[model samples]
Target: MPVELDPVKSAQKRSDYNGIYRLEDLTRLSEAVLSDSGQVDVMLKCTYDEQKLPVMLINAVTDVDVTCERCGQPMPLHIELAATFTPKTMRLEEDLVPSNYAIVEVNDYGLVDLRALIEDELMLEIPLVPKHEVENCAIKEQDMVWGELDKAAYEKPSNPFDVLKSLKNPK
Candidate 1:
């Protein structure tokens, strides 16, 4: 079934959900202007831990088209994310969150928009610097020569700080 969940109630029931959603339907993802039409497959479960903390687990996979930073070409990337979230009835201090899980707020209405949550996670998964594999990239020539000093300049270059040092130290 779909993943629309009331986090609190779902946790009580220890329910499991599975669904597929079109990538285009996630408006935030469209902001990147991705080139491909894809679908996100999601698996969700709501349960409690040994401490009876309300927890939600999500596993999702999808393909996304992103621009390669080096070549400026669209590349298809496969993304899979698995994470766990803890929902609190009352706002808790950040320090109270355990190391292994994330805290998601349960709004006053008690509805958790799983779609938006997944979208947020997907956004975070995008690479800060997306690039194709080095072998596949077209920038080999530019990369090789990017920092090379001009071999044609045979003359020794004058020191830029020589005049300043001479003025200050009078040596």
Candidate 2:
């Protein structure tokens, strides 16, 4: 079943569910952000504990395409992650501790926004550098050639100053 982040009902009774949440249902996230190649799928399974606080367990998998820094080749990367979230009543600070989980406040009806929570989890899972392993990798031939050329260029010194000094010193 689809879980909507109802701020009212969430505060009433602790709810737990196990299902696949659709990306379209998460209205809080911008469409452009979701369309990005890095995000593939996001799933959440969670429940509210006896204390009337929301507890979310999230599983997210994303596919990213990045260029190799060394070879300038497109690299396919996959990231899989899982985490837990706990809702709290305290006002979150602007610079609080960074965590994969999110805390949602229960409204008068004790409702929590499950969709928003899932979006947050997905955002946190993105990697800083998306790269694949070397050797038998899916790198473009042109990029590999460029990499070799670059390495050769660097290795072959064209230092005019050094050449002049050597000539003058006659060593």
User: How badly does each model clash, as a count of residue pairs?
Assistant: 0, 6
Model 1 vs. true fold: TM: 0.79
Write model 2 residue lDDT over 1-171, tens digit each, in one string: 444555324334444454554545544333424234333365555565454445666676655455556555666555576776665545434244246555566455545655565666555665555445656456644455543454566686677798789888985
> Could you tell me which 10 consecutive residues in candidate 2 have the lowest summed lDDT?
30-39
- C-alpha TM-scores of all predictions: 0.79, 0.47
Instruction: Report each candidate's C-alpha RMSD, comma-separated, in the order given.
Output: 5.2, 7.7
Which stretches in model 2 have alpha-carbon errors above 4 Å? 1-4, 7-40, 49-52, 90-116, 136-171
C-alpha lDDT values of all predictions: 0.81, 0.53
Per-residue lDDT tens digits for candidate 1, residues 25-63, read 888876774653788899998998776778899999988
Worst 10 residues of 1 by lDDT: 141-150
What lDDT, from 0 to 1, does candidate 2 have? 0.53
Check candidate 1 and list the clashing pairs: none
* Superposition error at 119 for model 2 (Å): 3.6
